[model samples]
Target: MKKLGFGCMRLPLKVKKINSSIDMTKTEEMVDYFINEGFTYFDTAYMYHDGRSERAVREALVHRHERQTFILADKMPVGMLVTKGDTSRIFRHQLKKCGVEYFDYYLLHALNAKYLERAEKLGVFEYLAKKKSEGRIKKLGFSFHDSAKVLDRILTRHPEMEFVQLQINYLDWEDEKVQSRLCYEVARKHGKDIIVMEPVKGGKLADVPEKVKELFALEHPDWSPASWAVRFCASLQGVICVLSGMSDMAQLKDNTGYMKDFEPLTQKETDILKTAAAIIKNEETVPCTSCRYCTASCPMNIAIPEYFTAYNKRLAGEDYKLYLEERAKDKGKASECIGCRKCEEVCPQHIEVVRLLKKCGEIL
Candidate 1:
């Protein structure tokens, strides 16, 4: 398989809203293009697209292709587990949802500090190991969001984890809050192969500021900004795959074009990316990836990512009234957050959601 994996989290949507229905026809086209180009890995989760992504995979890929031709990855939402038997119930449901008898890669999704405790109490690791022994799961791993210390502790306790998925990109590589480098080092220290998520920071790096765009254009005018971002992660030694949640054909083509003949970055390119990262750090923009992970669990049903997008555009000098017009459609504003903190717990970026929502109250 190639280093590029097709991420199904942000499949093309029929509507533009967060809970909009997927455009399965377009998704099937994108899946065909990806596999024909020799990329074989497809990643989906139980909560992605409001539990529609797994079914999208079944419709677009599994029904159309040979089972042995591709590798499919699904996740168990450990954070959403409320009962002792939820693990097995969800695992069986996922297989039925994805229309697969087994998963090539199965993960304990979004393993943070709180979720880790729940997983241990529920005997999640033991359950996954038993499934792996039964040949229902070929590879067992977890997608992580906490600090390096937590990661080290987990690895020490569960040496059975075959791979660790971390959010690694040039922008967040040295970020104190994200701790991408530290987590990468921890995974490598434990001799775990890495699978990278959010390589383009959920499209933030792909559409950077004019200054950063010009920097890339000056040297590699032919390459898309997303290419540079994905390659930066793929260039790393222990990284087995970099997943891009491609939403359209252009993105799929752009990714496969560069990844077909993969190349490690030169020292000069590395320095250029570091400089771009510095400029991005100085910008007064929200770090939200627009993944909508926060919105799924919000008690007040606030459209957190949409508000953040509006807030970011406001920071970029867009009119405030325009943001208000968009916010009207959402029907839930930032001021309605109520400090529940459920959104914060599931966020992969580890953003201070409550504080940011208060700021959004002031700005949007």
Candidate 2:
């Protein structure tokens, strides 16, 4: 896999949907530019953009480009599967959606303590092994969203996994809940290669506060903040690639520019990032990681993850008020949490979801 993989999660949207109406003219141009620049890895999941991501990748890259030219990676949506048979159905559907004969990488999507247990009890890992043996999937691993301790357990138990995908970035390097660095270390200790996702924290690092942007601009005014993020993930040893969810032509162009050159961060740049991380750490409200385990058990159909994401932005104070206002428009407001502890039950981070929702309601 290349050092920079294009994440298909936050692809261009139209009418608040995945925008199956992909800007193919520009997207095709971006794909040509990306491959010409020597970056060839693309990551998507079944649930991303409500299943439109797979088809979009087909239209944007797979159909237009040769199979061997790029590595296509997708994850099994284990959370949505109600029975063991659903795995084959979704995997088969993915093959059709992406217009691919085999996946370069396949993952057990978004594993945590609960989901891992579910997958194990239901024989998902074994099923993936069979698919690999049959040559439908090339490499098998998992995308994780839990604590370091849970990660340690998973790696210890599943040494057959080729690599692990993690949500790693400067912001969550030492986060108590996310523990990006801790999970990376755990994987490395197990001798597993890492696929880094969210190196830019869902594009939060792209356009940051003026002060944060100014700090980075002092180093290289020509480089976008996105470059620094890609460099940060690239700087980490044992990483196979850093996934960037590019949504527009400008972002794709800028990212491919830096990724083509593929330079890791310098010692000075690392120090600057560390300082910037500190600045961001002190500003976050609730310290939520947006893992969405809370949503699994919500009885009132509350969108706990969305609320927490919005609440964190509210905690960032004045600079992120726009984010707070936008997310607050959702039907599942913090005030609608219903005080159910169901969300807390599945949270590996043990976040006080109900109480925090209450606090967010007060603040926002």
Candidate 3:
């Protein structure tokens, strides 16, 4: 597998929505360049691109190349499953959608505390394992978004897992909210091969604050913002590949250039990034990972992640009043909590929902 895997979640969107429309020509060029560079890992899921990602993969990568030349990773859509029989149906649909007979890599998509429980109850792994034995799937694994403790518990019981995908980047390496270090440590402790996602923190680190950019430019003026992020994940001991959701061809070229013959960040470079991450963490007011678990149980139909995002920006301490003014543009702010405790219960991190909302409301 190539050190850089193309994430299909952020493929060119027409109207900022995944299913609005796709730019086929641009995607084709990017895929051609990606494969021409000797890279062969592509990842997609059901919910990506507003449920059109699988079909786009068929149009972009799967149909264009021989199955033997590249590896295609597809994920089970547990959120779409309503019963045990639905698993086979969804799997078959995915096969038809991607126009592939078998997947090189198959995962239980977006495993968190809630989704993991749903998967276990629905016998997802059993179905995937059975398919693997039947030669329809090559390797079975999962992409995780959960706490270190939850991840540890899952790995302990399912050591048969061939590999695990995690969100690993410099920003979340030491974050209490994302707990990237602890989660990766747990995966390594269990001897699981790690597939890294969000190496650029969903593109937030790609275009960093000017101060942080200036600092990195002093040492490696030629390195792009994305290079610093990819190197951070690649520097880790057990990372197999880092996934970058490149939306344009320029990003594709920039990333592959640095990742071609991968260079691990030196101790000095790593130290610099750590200092930069620290500065950003201090500046960020709301610390949300956008996992969507809290919104799963929100009673008042509030978008918890978006609210927290605004709240964090307000607390950034620079032009906070301006941040508050911007947040007012949203129809639903944090003040609409209505004292609902549903979100708190579903939060695996046990964030003080009411308290945080109160603080956020004060800002609003």
TM-scores, one per candidate: 0.81, 0.79, 0.80
lDDT of 3 at 107: 93
What lDDT does model 1 reach?
0.90
lDDT tens digits, residues 233-345, model 2? 88899998889888787888888777776778889999998888777666546656778777767776676666677666544422455665565455566777777588888
Q: Give the best candidate by lDDT.
A: 1
Per-residue lDDT, model 3, residue 189, is 96
**10 residues in a row with least lDDT, candidate 1:** 314-323
lDDT of 3 by residue, 101-213 (tens): 99999999888889888899999989899999999999889999889999998888888798999988888888787899999999999988899998987667886767899
User: How many steric overlaps does candidate 1 have?
Assistant: 0
Candidate ordering by lDDT (highest first): 1, 3, 2
The alpha-carbon lDDT assigned to residue 73 of candidate 3 equals 91
Task: Look at candidate 1 and tell me the lDDT of residue 11.
Answer: 92
Alpha-carbon runs more than 4 Å astray in model 2: 16-21, 284-364
lDDT of 1 by residue, 276-350 (tens): 998877866778998989888988988788777887776543455556676657567788778989999999999
lDDT per model vs. reference = 0.90, 0.83, 0.84
RMSD of each: 10.3, 9.9, 9.8
Q: Which ten residues in a row have the lowest lDDT in candidate 2?
A: 313-322
**Model 1, stretches more than 4 Å misplaced?**
18-20, 284-364
C-alpha positional error of residue 134 in candidate 3 after TM-score superposition, expressed in Å: 1.1
